[model samples]
Target chain A: MRKLKAVKITQAIVELVKRANFSLRKDVLFALRKAYGFEKNRRAKTILKAILDNAAYAQKENLAICQDTGMPVVFVQLGQDLKISGNLKAAINSGIESGYKKYSLRNSICKDPLLRGKSGFSPCIIHMDIVSGNKITLTLLPKGFGCENKSQLKMFKPTSSLEEIKSFIIDAVKSAGADACPPYVIGVGIGGSADYASLLAKKALLKKIKLQRGLSPKGTVPGLERELLFEINNLNIGPLGLGGRATALAVNIQTYPTHIAGLPVAVNISCHALRSAEIVL
Target chain B: MKRIYTPLDLNKIKSLKAGQEVFLSGTIYTARDQAHKRLVQAIKSRQTLPFELRDAVIYYCGPTQTPQGKVIGSCGPTTSSRMDAFSGFILAQGLRGMIGKGSRGLGVKEAIKKYKGIYFITYAGCGALLSKYVKSVKKVAYGDLGPEAILKLEVENFPLIVAIDVNGGSVYG
Candidate 1:
């Protein structure tokens, strides 16, 4: 078994958080630039241009891309053959705290859901998976609340048709409207149970925002993603919802098998500033 | 495009129309969820406010921590709809304008029309770029709220689009 020190995990997380906050992912940037080219409305075009300029400025200055540094969510793919020397969870939390403090990122996590106390950095949300590998992979997604608040999930009956599912997804974006900030990158999760579907939807957001992508390896419908993307952009919500052709930059779908009684679908919307970073150790 | 300054009055606000791009300068106060709640409570209890409300513009923002040697950190507009619940009362207290992103609730639209106030929106999720306009910042109230604290910011040529105007005209439609 390969041994790794806990402090090493802490150090990696610190750098990952900074990278995620300070820069826009290249894939996302490409989508934004493409949308800017396609947008015809003068206001929409201007908004897209400003968005591009903002991303560039944030990266150059080593600053937080947006004021809401977001709730730090860490995805850990732990290798079956690797062993850790110290408290792994503690190490991760301490790293998050140190990263936020060191770089002046906002402390957005509240201690309690109901009481709503002061914000702090420790105890970030973590999802762990044991995989067949010798190296650990850590992916960080700093989810801002504006778009996160608009996430929707529905348990459709087994008999529901594809059209119904498509409408549901489109309606989710329609209801989100201008409130969550557009042009949005949509992530859809289908077939899992309710909570699992929500997780899958969020995971779908981590997929690269490519112009051309293949069918999901997990058996999700192939043409549905493309159809949904076309229909959503037609909503005229546009960038900043001022109306234009570039309402949605991309629509990514992920699927898993489910029981015969139901089909659960969840939609996760990300604003233009979708920030994430990953590291392997 | 038009140029406007803060401490805006009813006449200046009424002259503006929705969808007009404006470059705003001068002072504005920053307040978000908690600060709005506290301000409402202070008003209800008949206590003195941290800043004057007459002809004032309230920006719905919560800025990041100021970096060393900088006037402020990434200070951007947050969702304006989240503050809709408190806006009617706040507007009645002589508030002249609001700056944030997204569309307002129906009540807020009605309030803006009734009170002859203007609602301007800056680029959403563009905090780092927006911070360049802020020439100076200082904590005005609720210091314990950390980022949520009310702040007084002096800005120069801040870019804004009039999302809603005093005549109930809205760019959202």
Candidate 2:
């Protein structure tokens, strides 16, 4: 079995956190530029330009794209044949603590949900998967509360029509208004159990931003992604919900097979920043 | 773009219309949910506010830490809707303007009309660019809240759009 040092993992996590916060991915930048071109409202155009400029400033000055560095959501794909030498969770949390402190990132985590107190940015949330390989892959998605708070999951009977599903997404996005930050990305997960469906939706957000908009991965309903994108943009929420043509940049969907009795759907939204980074070890 | 100075008076805010682009300059206070709660509590308990509320522009932001040898960190508008409930209370205290991102609730709109207030929306997710406008920042109150502490910020040419006018007109509509 291949042996991987936990310190190396911790180092990777630390670097990933910095990269994710400071840099806007190329695909995401391209999408923002594309939205700027397609957006008709002059106000929306100005806001998009500011967003693009902000991204450039972040990259140049080594500053976080947004003050809300966000909670570290780490996705780890561990090799089945590899042995981790140190405590995995401990290493992950240690990296987050050190990186956040060293970079002066905001500490947004609370001690508990109801009774809010400082958690010192410890206990990083991590999702792990075992795959057939010798290399471990880690993707860090720093999810801000603005977009995360607006995500929703709904379980409908299998008999629900496609139109019903479509409206559900539309209403959710419309109601979210500028709160979730418009001209954002939408990740949809369909057909899994409640929790699994939401997880899939969140995972879908980490996928590459394609040149083509609303392109779902395999096994999803064909063309549904594109159709939803059109409907959502037509809502006229625009950039920052100030009213315009570019409410959503893209809508990506991932689906899984589920029991016949029920269909679970989850919608995860991401702000225009869409900060994410990955590393392979 | 039109330019507006801080410590905005009711007359000046009332002249602004929804969707008008404006560059704001002068002093502003920074506060998010936690500081807002305390502000309201102070008012209800008949205690002095952390800052003078009359004609003040409150920014809905929680900036990252000021790095070594820096005046401030990346600072951007947070979601405005989260503070919708407390907006009316603050407005009633004689606030002239607010800067944030996103839409406001109907209650906030009504209060804006009743109190003749302005809701300014800045570029969302553009903290780095926005920080360029902030000349200086000093913690004024609630340091225990960390990033959510109330701050006195001196800004120059801070870009914003009037999302809600004193007449209750909203850009989101």
lDDT per residue as tens, model 1, A58-155: 88987788998888889999999999899988989988999988888897777888877787866788999999878999999999899999999999
Among all candidates shown, the one with the greatest lDDT: 1
Query: Which residue pairs does candidate 1 place in steric collision?
Result: none
Clash pairs, candidate 2, are none
Candidate 1 displacement at residue B88 in angstroms: 0.3
**lDDT of model 2 at position A36:** 94
Can you tell me which runs of candidate 2 are displaced by over 4 Å? A213-222
Which has the greatest DockQ? 1
Cα lDDT, model 1, residue A6: 96
Tens digits of per-residue lDDT for model 2, A1-281: 99999999999889988899999988899999999998888878988998899999988887889998888899999999889998988998889888888888888888788988653666678999999989999999999989999999999989998889999988879778888777879989998799999999999888776666446564345477778888898988888887788898888888899999999999999998898899999
TM-score of each: 0.98, 0.96
Interface RMSD values for the candidates, listed in order?
0.9, 1.2
lDDT of each: 0.90, 0.88
Instruction: Please estimate how well model 2 matches the true structure, expressed as its whole-model Cα lDDT.
Output: 0.88
